[model samples]
Target: MSPATAVVLCALAWTVFLGAHLALNGRWWPWLAVSLLPPPLFAAAPLALLLAAAASGSVPGAVLAAGCLLAGWRQSGVNSRAVRRSSPERAGIRVVSWNTQHWNQGREPDRFYAFLHSLPADIYLLQEYLNGFEGGEVWDIDDEERLRREFPGHHLSVDNNSVTLSRFPPAGPPVPVGACSLRVDVRTPDGILSTYNVHIPVQLTVMNPLSRAFFQDMRRRHGARRREYDALVADLLANPHPFLVSGDFNTSAAIGDIRRMPRAAHDAIGANRSLFPASWHARWRLRLWRIDWVFTSAGVRAEQYTFRDPGGLSDHLAQDVTITTTAIEEMNR
Candidate 1:
C-alpha cells in the first residue's frame, strides 16, 4: 500500500475508536463494550494520531485529531478553574467517603485503623464493610464493638455491606435502596441531611471481552447497574430533605451511569480543576478511572472536595468533601 493510503487507513481507524467514546451513552450493549476501558486511551490515542497527521501532512487526519481532542476534553470532565478553593468553610460539615476493601482485614491492620482515625470528617460514608471476598462469595465483617471503641461518640449505621459512621445524631433508621446503596439520615446542626452510601455492581465480571460469555455477562451486569441507578434516582427525586450521595459507584465519569444521576444534585468533583481526577486502582498508582464520587442536592454546596491517597490501605482513594447548606434553606428548616 502507498504511504498516503496507509496514513488514511490508520487515521480512519483512530477516528472510529475515538468517536465511539463520545457517541455511546446509557447502559446498553454498545456502551458495555468500551465502558471498562481506561480514560488514558482518550488522551494517548488522539496525541498519537495528531503526530502522525503532522508528519504525513494529512488535513483529514488533523481534523479527526481535533475531534478526538474535543472528545477527550468532554470525557475527562475538565473544569475552567485550575483548582477549587482549598479553604473549607468553617460552618460546612466535612464528610470522608471511601470503599475500604473489607476494612482492616488486609495486610496492615494498624495502619488501616490509624488512617481511619486521622480523616477530619463529621460524617463517614464507607462502603465494602464486609470481610474480603472468599471463593467468589462474600463474608461478613463484624467490627461494631471495635468501631464503637475507636470512634467513641459517633453513631454507626450498617445496611448490608455499606456503613455510615456519623458524629451527628440519627434522624432515622438505615434504609436499604435496592442492593447497591444504603440510605442513612443524620440530624446535623443545620438540619436533617439524607446521605446515600453506594457501591454499584462492577461491570463485566466475566472479563474476557472477546468471548460470548463475556458479552452475556456484560448485558446482565449493565442491566443490574442501570436498575441501581434508576432506584437511587427515583428515591432522590422523592426525597424532601437535602441529600448527599457518596461512595464507590464503580461507574466512571465517561459512562452513562453518571449521567443517570438526578439533575437536582451537583457532582462534588465538578468543582475539581484537574481534567483527570481518578480514585480507583491505587495499587498501580496510575489513578486512571474515577469510579468513586460524591454528589449533593441543590441547597447543599460542597465548600471543598478532594481525593486523598488511601496510603496503601485500599485500592480506591478517599473522597473528602466539606458541604454546607444554603442560608435560605437553613432558615426555612
Candidate 2:
C-alpha cells in the first residue's frame, strides 16, 4: 500500500475507534449528523486493525491503543470485578451500598430477598426502600419483613426511604436528617459503628417524570436540593462517632463540593482510577454524573472499592466496598 494511503487508513481507523467509544456511551449526536453514517463504523474490524497498528512503538500511539482497548473492554462486558471476592479479615467490616432501584421493582419479592441474601456484607445500606409509593400506601412491607426473617441475627431499621440491614442492633432510633438522610449507631462485634444512610434528593437535572414536573421551577428547586445536601454534611460532621457514610448522593465524584468534604470523607470508588472516568458524565451513557457514592470518616479504612456493572437490573451499578475499622484507627493515630 502507498505511504499516503496507509496514513489515511490509519486516521480513519482511529476516528472510527473513537466514534464507537462515544457512540456506545450514547454520546454521538453532532458527529452522527456531520458524518451521516451509522454506528457500525466503530465496530468495523479494518478500523480496529488500523488503530492497533498505528498505536504501536510511539508513546502517543500506545496511549491511543490503551484507550481503544479499554473502551472495547467495557463494551464487551467481560472487564469487571465480578468474581473478585472480598478478603476475610479477623477484625474488619464489609459494607455494600446500593440504590436497589426499589426492592419491588423488577424482580419478585422472593428473588430480591435471595439476591440480598447472596451478598456477604456485615452492613447493607440501601436507598429507595419503598415504604409507600404512588398513593400513601405501604409498598414492600412484606419484603422488609422477609429481610428481617432471613437475617434474624441482624437489626433492621427503616427511616423514611432508606433502610439499614445490620448484623448488630442499632443503639438508638434511625436519626433523620431532613427528608432524605439518616444516621444510626449500630452495635458491631468490635464496637458501636455509626452508619449514615443518605439518599440526597436526586438533582433536578436527573429527576424522573413526577419530580421533574414538581421541580419545574429550576432555580428554587435546585437551590433547595443543594442546601439540603450542605445541611446533611454539616450534621454528619457534627455527629460524634467513627462512621461509614453510604448511599446515593445524586452527584458526581468530580463535584467540588463533594471533593471538599473533610479529607476524612474519602470516596472508596475514587481509589480505582481506572473504573469511572475522572470527568463526570452529563447524561445517561454520556454519564458525567456519579450521584451514587460511599464516603468514610477518619475512623474507617477502605480496603477496596469495586464498582460492579448493573447487570441490566438497575440504571446505576452497585458499589461494593470492603472496609475495616483498623484502617480508621491507624489513620487517627
Candidate 3:
C-alpha cells in the first residue's frame, strides 16, 4: 500500500475508535467527541472534561484545568460580603435552602456541618432530614441536640422530617401545612419575617417500572401532592408580611404553576441552574433538573445566588443566597 493511503486509513480507524469510546463512556473519551455533540451537550461536556483533567493531568488539557479552577472558586467556602454580614441587625436577613440528602448519611456528617458553619444566615431551611423514627423507633434526640448547639441563640423546630433553625425568636406557633412543610414567623430588625420550610413529594414518572408503579400508588393514596403545594402557596400570598420561603420543591422553577407565583417570589438560584448532576451511571443519566428553591415576597430582592458543589457527601448540592429589601419605592416620570 502507498504510504499516503496507509496514513489516511490509520487516521480514519483511530477517529472511529475514539468516537465509539466516547459514546460508551463520557468521562475522558467524550472530550474528543465534544465537537460532534449538540451545542448544549458540548457546552456542559467541558465541565466534565475539566474535572477529569484536574484528577488526571494530560497535554492539550489546559482549558479543562482552568474551568475546574473557576467552578471550584464558588465552592471554596469563602463567605462573600453578603454572607458575612447577614445578621438581622446589620445587613438584611439571609435565608439559605438546601437538600442535605438525609444529612449526608452516605458520608461524614462533619462535611455537611462544615458547609453550614460557613454561613451566618438568620433563617435556615433544610430538607431530607431523617427523623430515624420511620420504622416506629424512638426519635433522634442526639441529632436534634447537635443542631441546637450548632446554631446557638436560635429558635429551633424539627418536624421529625424537616428542620428549621433560626437566630431570631419564633413569632408564632409552628403551623404545619403538610407532612413536608412548616410555617413560622421569626423576628427581624425590620419587623417579623414569615418563612416556610418545605420538602415536596418527588416526581416518580422518570424512574423504573417498579419505582414508577410505587410512585403512582403514592399519588393515588395522597390525592395529588401538587395541589397541596398550590394551596400552601396561595395561603402565603394571601397573608400580609415580608415573606421568605425555601426548600426542595421537587420541581423546576420554569414550570407554569411555579412561574405564576409572582416573579417577586422566585428562587435565588434562578430558574436555569441545574442542582443535580445529569448523569449518575451511564444508562441512568438524563437532562438537568432544578428541584430545590428559595422564594420571597415583593419586599425582598435577591442580591446574590449560588449553587454549591457536592463536598463528596450529598447527592444534591447546597444553594446559598443573599437577599435585600429597601423601603424606597421607584417613581415613574
Clashes of 1: 0
Q: Write one digit per residue (lDDT tens) for candidate 3, span 1-333.
A: 654444334334434533453344212222222222322332334454545444554433535334433433332212234334333433556777777666755567777788887776777888777733221342332477788777887788777367788888888877776667888877666676778887776433334636656545545423444555676767676667677787776544212234335545754543223333221112222434445667877667666666655554555656666767645332111
lDDT of each: 0.78, 0.59, 0.56
After TM-score superposition, what is the CA distance of residue 287 in candidate 1 from its true location, in Å? 2.9
Among these predictions, the greatest TM-score belongs to: 1
Candidate 2's residue-wise lDDT over 24-138, tens digit each? 3212222212222322333343345545556443334444445555454423312134345544444457787777766557556666666666677888887787744432254
Candidate 2, superposed: residue stretches over 4 Å from native: 1-91, 131-142, 205-216, 257-260, 270-273, 277-289, 327-333
TM-score for each predicted model, relative to the true structure: 0.86, 0.62, 0.60
Task: Pick the winner on lDDT between candidates 2 and 3.
Answer: 2
| For model 2, the run of ten residues with the poorest summed lDDT | 26-35
Worst 10 residues of 3 by lDDT: 276-285
Q: After superposition, how far is residue 38 of candidate 2 from its true place, in Å?
A: 22
TM-score of 2: 0.62
